[model samples]
Target: MCFYDEMKGYHWDSVESEIMNRSRDDVEKALTSSSMNLDGLMSLVSPAAEPYLEEMAQRAHQVTQQRFGRVISLFAPLYLSNECTNSCVYCGFNMTNRIDRLTLTAEEALVEARAIRRLGFQHILLVSGEAPHLVTLPYLTSVVDLLRPLFPSISIEIYPMDTSSYEELIKHGVDGLIVYQESYNEDVYKQCHPRGRKSDFHWRLETPDRGGNAGFRRIGLGALLGLANWRVEAFFLALHAQYLLRHFWKSFITISFPRLRPAAGAFEPPCPVSDVQFVQLLAALRLLFPDAGLILSTRESPYLRDHLIPLGITSMSAGSRTEPGGYAHETHAEAQFAVADERPPEIVAEVIRSKGYEAVWKDWDAAFLH
Candidate 1:
């Protein structure tokens, strides 16, 4: 039986409704309360939380500064392939799309890794579409083996695999995994990912559990903002994060907020998230979980990225190229999306330094993994 079929009791619609019904007073109490829980998180994201954004932001800023200092960890995404079997409607790499498909060989991956290192990035996120036949466990293992010796830290933003597969990758030196739920609304998730392995919501939902079990160092969770009510979706993401933290206390956890950017063969978000609301959500999350790593991507404009530096964002991606072989072998292949902040890595590093924050390149050591 499928994972979802086995866990029929978990319904996303009911949770969404509960979040929608939260009152403003509830939001206030949650923001000011000495201890913030799931209920407090719901209030902070509900309509009732709008008036208290400033106060929440202040508390969040202080908390974030205390924990992470003024430095923002910087990283970049390296797209290895655009080949996918999944049919995610909101992604440019969906299988049905007629776009150039490319997968980096071991040498090609090393070439891209060198370019990333030259850009002063020690942290790298390897992204690919769900093409299990082409990008299987062994293939990923080889890629990790090749790149692990080059970059100290490597994370993957690829399809979900079994715990054993994850364990194998961990043994080969993979440190982190970022698997976004896209949206927790099951019906919406179904409508978006209509075909392939990604269609299984529960398998994806329980992926972090598997990752934690596999003894991976860190697991990242996120929602593609603009797909549904940002507040409701964010609440669920936070809940999932809390669950992972409680269950996997030894493993690190990070959260990302990726606003849906314009992409080929994808629908625009149903409810767009504005700049102010995005900042508010980030601040709210920082206040709720002071130690959690909050990451920003190149999807937002440079102005927004600059403004967000002081508002609780702890990590960022700079000079990102979303298409496969984009850094080393620029091709006309389809990118996951067009990156908004097109500044070169050096320029982005300069911006980060000007903001009085050191741009971190190397934070992890491969020797420690062994």
Candidate 2:
């Protein structure tokens, strides 16, 4: 059954009460438990656990080290296009935004890909705006055909597609999929995406299931932190992730925490997550899902990201450019979001090494797929 079916069985009242009314004792019990469950995770992520940040960090660090080791997977985002049809209120690519747009030709994409390869990132995440006509399956397949031979692992972070579309992508060499629900709260979700195909929340929610059925090796889920109450959004994200883990056991799951950043929309966040709470949330997620990958993107500031590395983050984006043709061309499209950590990939790798963690670029390969 899908998570929406489970949502029908749950009452938001109990969930809000469980999180908002959690006591220090509840937090303590969750942290001290020999093994974690949903109840423990709820308590740990609650505000009651704020005071025990150090303890949570220590436990989370231990759990992560036990499962994965002192290694950070490094990757870069290759923006394929910024020509969007969706009117997402929070995104820079909203159709109403007056900005220069770009849809990279296959040659331009290769130019950008070759530059990224020189930066030593063999794993490239191909990103695009949610314009069905502009970024169609055939278009994506051609892009994959152009870069699959150069990059060891290629992933997508574009509009969601059906199982058949994803299967076609897998056939052409797309190795992973990252589809953020944007917000799990249906009311808030509809409010944010008022126009275009993205208005269909249920279809977007089922994209990962479609990806799993298409046999993608890895699938990612996330909620934009500012869309709803961060705590509630995170709780539901954990629930969604756990469901996928149980059902799609073969796919490696990763969760990304993308906080609000400056975009073309220039919309202010209703509730911004503080550095302290961000750390606490990351640690709680790590403790609860020890084997799951926690990704910290360049959206966070350098100081905050530096402190967060060992806390629970397993993967990170370095030297990222959020605009189409951003890396290769000087006259590129406006960025969807400005990157906070401007450090080049080499500098980021050195930082990882200085912390005694190995920087991994290609631990995955297509050879095993056959």
Candidate 3:
């Protein structure tokens, strides 16, 4: 069964009750447990856990060090195109927007890839607006084949597709697949993606499952926080991650927390998660799933990102450009969203080193695929 099947039994209303009702005693009891369960996770995400920030962070840091060591895996996002058909209200690439659109040819993408490589990013995530007709499977295959020789890790944060398409991408050397649910609240999700194939919420929800079935070694999951109550979104997100872990045991499942950032649409996160609460949520996830990888992006501020590295963030992006063909071009197209941390790769790496941690640019070699 797809994750949707497993998820269908639960609803947001019920989950909201469990998390919101967690009391201070619940948080204390959950934190004291030697091994955390889903209830423990819910307690950690509770508002009651806010005052226990220091205790949570201390435990989260210890858990991370034990599981991942003092290493920060690094990567970059290379936006291939900003041409999208979806009318996602929170995005700059919404179809109704009046902006210049461009999809790079394979040659142009190579130039961008080489530029990214120069910045010491061996891992690259190719991003595009959901314009499948413009960014077809064959188009993506050629681009992946081109960069397969340059970068060791190539991930995609684009439109979702069937298992066959994911298998095809793997054949051409794409290993990492990152897809966000945007919001787990079904009603809000439908309203957020009013039109286009993205409007099919279950299909988007099952994307990582499809990717896992197609044998992707790394399958990334996340929620676009701010769409609904972060606690509600995070509970379902943790549930999804847990489901993937149980069913797809061989796959390395990753979780990312992409809070809403400003875009051309002037949209805002309805229930904005404060920085302290965001940190609390991260610590909760770390404590609950000690082995899972947590990825942070340039969507966060430099000060916050730096503060968060030691807390529980295992991987991060630096010197990221969210526009199509942004790396090589001086005049870039409109960005999907404005980036918060704009430090270059070297500087970010320097900052990581200053914390007495190693910033790793490359973690996977193709030989491991065997």
* Candidate that would win on TM-score: 3
What is the TM-score (0 to 1) of candidate 2?
0.98
How do all the candidates rank in terms of lDDT, highest first? 3, 2, 1
Off by over 4 Å in 1: 1-14
RMSD of 2: 1.1
By the lDDT metric, which is better: model 2 or model 3? 3
* TM-score of every model versus the real structure: 0.95, 0.98, 0.98
- Give residue 24's lDDT in candidate 1 (0 to 100): 79
Worst 10 residues of 3 by lDDT: 361-370
**Clashes in model 3: which pairs?**
none
Between prediction 1 and prediction 2, which has the larger lDDT? 2
The candidate 2 region of ten consecutive residues with least summed lDDT is 5-14
The per-residue C-alpha lDDT of model 1 at residue 348 equals: 80
lDDT against true structure, model 3: 0.91
Deviating ranges (above 4 Å) for candidate 2: none
State the C-alpha lDDT per candidate: 0.85, 0.88, 0.91
RMSD of 1: 2.2
lDDT of 1 by residue, 1-370 (tens): 2223433544567766887787877876786688888778877877677778888888887888899888888899998889999988889998999998988886888899889888889889999999888888888888888888778999999999889999999999999999999988888899988999999988899898889889888899999998888887777777788778877898888999999988988577888998878977898788778889999999999999987887788889999999988998868889998899999878887888898887778778888788
Better of 2 and 3 by TM-score: 3
C-alpha RMSD of each candidate structure in angstroms? 2.2, 1.1, 0.9
